[model samples]
Target: MSRSCPSRDAGLFPSEAEIARRLSQTPQEWAAKAKVLERDGLPRVDPLMGGRFWPAVRAYFLARYGLAGAEALAPDGPENLDAL
Candidate 1:
């Protein structure tokens, strides 16, 4: 991906405080998980912009919960017993 793909021009969080705000986590909580988040493929903070790559966060969640990783949909809508 291009460097511009997930940058401040694209609404980057821009600071640890802002990142925590965006993620609904307190600063302490974010700091605690920062390393693990990066280990799991979250983009590293860019020093120049004091921001991280937003697309990486989106990509992570999408891969984890949006499509392939989620529970399968009910076969026949809400009434399908097989889905249970």
Candidate 2:
């Protein structure tokens, strides 16, 4: 008898590299922006993962660009950016 393996779901978040690519910025620039966000009391990056999840990224976009800017960059609605 063959045992079935569970399917793995794709990660629902973008990595720092992906974020940087989307923003047309370097990884270092993204990291610097992340630092500013943290200093301003936004969600901190995951220390262990060295990355931000979709919510954190969304917050960053909103904070940096405002609603209109985020809407322009997000292909789907800004609220749906993190939807899996």
lDDT of 2: 0.59
What local lDDT score does residue 4 receive in model 2, on the 0 to 100 scale? 20
Q: Write model 1 residue lDDT over 14-56, tens digit each, in one string.
A: 5666566677998779878887878877788878766776767
Cα-based lDDT for every prediction? 0.67, 0.59
Score candidate 2 by TM-score against the native.
Answer: 0.47
Q: For each of the candidates, give the backbone clash count.
A: 0, 0
lDDT of 1 at 7: 48
Q: Model 2 over residues 1-84: C-alpha lDDT tens digits? A: 222222211243456656666669887797787677778755665776544566666666677666634443446535665676
